[model samples]
Target chain A: MIPFEHIMILSAAIFLLGLIGLFVRKDALTLLVCMGLLIMAVGVLWIAVAKSFGEMLGQGVVLAIIATAFVQGCVGVMLILKLQVHKPSLQVKQFTELKG
Target chain B: MRVELFYLIAILCLFFSLGAVFSTKVVTSLFCFLGCVLTVTLLFVLLQASAIAVIYMLLFCLLVSIYWVTAIVFLPKPNKNAYSKHFLHVGVFLLLGGWLLFVLLPFLQVPAFSPAEIDHGFGSARHLVNVLFGPLRHLWYALLALILAFLISVPVLIRDNTKCGDLS
Candidate 1:
């Protein structure tokens, strides 16, 4: 078995990568993708700690989170498509007029 | 041996995740995102969360379908200036963020606490179904209803907006 700390470190690294991607990417689709990665990283972290404690709730939470992520991705894509239909662009800068 | 494989999968997951974030073309980035999800699913399998692994694999199929639809419908033009403009800033953030996570690593470490008689079948689908429909049944049903509502309302919202010329 791998040391528990190693898995924690890997999960942390993935979480950070997702955070960076969220910050750097301006496209809505890319942002949605990063959000999914972030959610996955959190699920991994939950599983790791839950395994250490010998509990099943973490896995259950992970399953729920994945389902929620699926719904979120679908809604996000639909909103993006609606935006594209109106504006014909997917760039974040193009939508800045609504920032106020 | 399994530990080594876990490490290999972790590295691949990180590499593909970075590729997904940094790729210039949208399609390439989407493909890399799929790769990252697949690698993470493999990690779940290695961790013995077979049900979550299978669920993620199914979710990955759904994601790929969404990717294809977005690719055909949106067809975003590549942002040529994104890399050159944001590379330095993101690199600095990553360096500092990584250092912070490394420093916090010791605090996050949990002592090995595996029970003597661990339930090896904890993450099986049967176990999951029992848990969801047992103690967590109400919450699960509520979430399902919410998701269904959202699914039904989104298209209606879009159509209404289009009809009202709000989106035009």
Candidate 2:
């Protein structure tokens, strides 16, 4: 079995990648994708720690997170599609005028 | 041997995730993201979370990827020049941030891996069900209610937005 520390480091790296992607990407779809990556990283961390502790709760939480992520991904895509339909663009900069 | 395999899988996941983040085309990035998910699933399997691995395979690899592909198919072709100009700056900052996290996290005294005796039913569906319905039952109900609320409200919200000419 792999060490928990290594798994934590790997997940952290992936999480950071997602964070950077969230900031660096310009498209709403890409931002949503980055969010998915961030969610996955957290799930991985949870599982790793839980496994190390020999507990089943982490697996259960990860399962719940997976379901939640699926729903979020679908809803996010729908919203992005709606925005695209209105503006014909997925660029994040295009939607900055919603201060009202 | 398992550690080496874990390292290999971890490296693959990292590489593909970077590709997913940095690839120029949306389709390419999505494919890379799929690859990253696949690698992570494999890592989960290695870590003895077979159920989580399977769930991820189903949700991320199958469901999410399909949804993304369909969305991409309907989306107008993305602008090729849509990337931010500050790539180097962002990359450097993220690297520094990650390093800082790595350095500081060990102080938290998170438990290290000390392999417990393998329970044959550890990640089985029965175990998951018991855990969910046993001690974590309240959480399960809350999550279910949240999901139901989201599902029920989204259409109404969208319809109202459209009627109000806010989401045209």
Candidate 3:
């Protein structure tokens, strides 16, 4: 059987993968998707830590997470709308037009 | 043993997290992320934090997914070429994984700190609400204020000046 620590390590691994994707992908939308993965990985880490302690009440953290996700959604919508203003393409390379 | 159950849920969370990260399709990745959150929420339940788990599932998994999908629907599909060109990223992932394993192996070999154990009373939502309203209430109100500011700023930020019906 896999140990809890092993499972946490696996989540970390997955998060690292997402991080790499976030750094390497130049496409803004793909970066957002990778960021979402990173967020999911962190949530798994939170759950693992909570379970390890044997205490309950992840409410505050959950609430905070939902709020952060909402903020991210807002930012994403704004970015897409901004993209509509400057360029039709979602590629970060094309964003060079905004460069000073 | 309870440890075994904890490990099972942890593995489920990890697998779904990995799926969420590595899946190329954005929608599929979101689904996998939802699975990951659900597993984590179950882990929270096992920890006796039913309130947190339920909130996480309801808000993060269900509601946030809807918000993200709706947001993405407005954007064009991402370019395929740049994403597929990231071969070096795989090497970076492996290196990071190895470094993490090296750092964690020693710590994992030891037993967890006893003081870190979950408190018994932590499962009660009544206590949580009471505590939040007592000391943390200000923080909650601050968050609300921040959201209000964000709502007010959206129109000023996204107004279409050109009226060309999207720059595309």
What would the per-residue lDDT of candidate 3 be over residues B98-151, giving only the tens digit for each residue?
467446634543222111222234544564576567677788899899999999
> TM-scores, in order shown?
0.72, 0.71, 0.58
What DockQ do the predictions score, one after another? 0.54, 0.53, 0.26
Model 3: lDDT to the true structure: 0.59
lDDT for each residue of candidate 3 in A1-100, tens digit (9 for 90 to 100): 2256765785687688779877766656556656766766676566556556643334556556656865685687567666756666556787766553
User: DockQ order of candidates, best first?
Assistant: 1, 2, 3
Worst 10 residues of 2 chain B by lDDT: B110-119
Look at candidate 3 and tell me the lDDT of residue B138.
85
DockQ of 1: 0.54
State the DockQ, from 0 to 1, for candidate 3: 0.26
Provide the overall lDDT of each model, using Cα atoms, as 2-decimal numbers.
Answer: 0.74, 0.73, 0.59
True contacts kept of each: 0.52, 0.62, 0.28
- Model 3 stretches astray by more than 4 angstroms: A1-11, A43-62, A85-90, B62-121, B137-168
TM-score of chain B as predicted in candidate 3? 0.51
How many Å off is the CA of B133 in candidate 3? 1.6
Two-chain complex of model 2, DockQ on C-alpha atoms against the true structure: 0.53
